[model samples]
Target: MPESIGPRDEGDTEPVRLPDGNLEHLDATVRQLLDQSAEQARQLDNLASAPAGSPFAGFPPGPAMPAPAPAPRPILELEGEEFESEVDTLTDWVETFLMDTYGDEVSTAAPWCLQWQEHEDVLAWLHALWLAYHQHKEPDAGLAGMAVWHRDFLTHTMAAVRAPGGSLSACMTDPDRPAHRILPGPQRSARRTGASTPDTGEAPA
Candidate 1:
């Protein structure tokens, strides 16, 4: 109801002076509003350009997608042909060992020795024993070498091959025919009788 204020005429151009403190306060308020607007624009720009799973979106990049597990190694399976080849090699090695070590005595004293090749069980057992001895024989076993070979290896093999129902015995047509013989007389005497006799068929008198 009081007298209404009207807009000033363009011709009234006199400048009005404000208080220094008021001018300073108004300037500070304008600067603060401008700085807030700038910060909001920068944040908007970053959001627009960010990747799908970026940490800036909100949550940290989902636990770096767990690494894939390593593949398992394949198992080795031995085939039948491989097994047979191994057996043949083992058999040949055993036969060579016998011929090299006791060929003369075996040929002279054990005439049935020629038939050993035909007996698979005999070959297998002897080959196994020979493998064990070849692995563990002592370097310093001089005379004892013959003793251990004849007693442990030879005797065991002969017994296995000459048992009543053994491979060698099964091949015999005559019941009275000997399937095998002990180590030659002199070889046996040298081992058991403690006589320092040579294995050359000479009796220790």
Candidate 2:
């Protein structure tokens, strides 16, 4: 009888093992193919959603918006001669601005006053007043009052008046009038009489 090499213990049920190197290479190829498909899908999605109004509707722009121009460096130091000259020019105007705005109340007993004539350093003093003026022009009375007060009192206390916080609001409020007292306007009367308040946010040009 021929050697019984025909019959094996395990029939066709056993799984065939692949070479380790071949299996690794196959896996790598499959991953690469999957990654390529994902990338292609992203590109399709981007193309479909391109905005019609944008300049780069089809593709990304080559360059982005240019950065803002660098701020100019200040030439004059706060206490320098150049700064003094600038302050001097502004002094006359500032003093006149206050006087014209408040008239006699600026002279009399008032919470806010600008005695521009009393200061020895007219230029610096004037600059201080101007700083105060700008500060008082704010919509918020508290902020404006704060700026003016800081500019007026703090300007004297400190050697330099470089930073005056409430000056803008100070300029806005009538120096003669307290912060609570609203200026004479139709709006004020309306509010007091339980009438409708008109749009007073923007003043006529």
Candidate 3:
């Protein structure tokens, strides 16, 4: 670096040695800068090469969209302890909330069984209702969730489940005259013999 320093042939040609730490740090800094510049240049090139009016043009890639939620499942598919557990929770919702609010006047037309859970059909319908109620109440269900439940799940299910000949009809047509019965299921053999062509498929009936 000084004029006094001679050519390699005439004097020492070894380069000035910096401290090991300082040299390593300087090398790392230079490499990092080069790598950053290269990345910026690649991004710019991508933008320039993008096709006009392309959805990807001039825009950075965004975060991936979340996976869709799973559809609700049937309650009857559960077995053993799982079936019992779900039914317990469903029973709580029915007694504490649903009945307290919507248990209308008992009559022959709109029958409601005092022991509705004993009816297999009632269990199925109420289980479906309970599942929908929870699904719509979730944050993902949006602001109209409860209203949707009332319309799509509640209103429709209530009408069908409480019809005069609905599942509960045989149980509690009149609360004052409460009774429970599971209508006899005809023997499968008899049913098939009669309905095989008769009960099942009548002659163009």
Candidate 3 residue runs with Cα over 4 Å from true position: 1-72, 185-205
Model 2 C-alpha lDDT per residue in residues 39-101, reported as the tens digit of each score: 777766766788768655546335678999754223233447765666566656655654465
In the range 60-177, model 1's lDDT, one tens digit per residue, is: 2336677887532211122477645655665576567765665433222233344564455565676566655653466666657767877887777756655654454334434345
lDDT of 3 at 176: 86
Q: Give the Cα-based TM-score of candidate 2 against the true structure.
A: 0.28
- Judging by lDDT, tell me the better candidate of 1 and 3: 3
> TM-score order of candidates, best first?
3, 1, 2
What RMSD does each model have against the real structure? Answer: 24.5, 18.7, 7.8
Query: How many residue pairs clash in each candidate at the backbone level?
Result: 0, 18, 2
Looking at candidate 3, the ten consecutive residues that score lowest on lDDT are 196-205
- lDDT (C-alpha) at residue 73 in model 3: 60
CA lDDT of every candidate: 0.58, 0.49, 0.82
Arrange candidates by lDDT, highest first: which order?
Answer: 3, 1, 2
- TM-score of every candidate relative to the true structure: 0.32, 0.28, 0.56
Best by TM-score: 3
lDDT of 3 by residue, 93-177 (tens): 9999998898788889888877787777788999999989998999999999999999999988888888887777787887789
Error of 1 at 134 (Å): 1.5
Clashing pairs in 1: none
TM-score of model 3 (CA atoms): 0.56
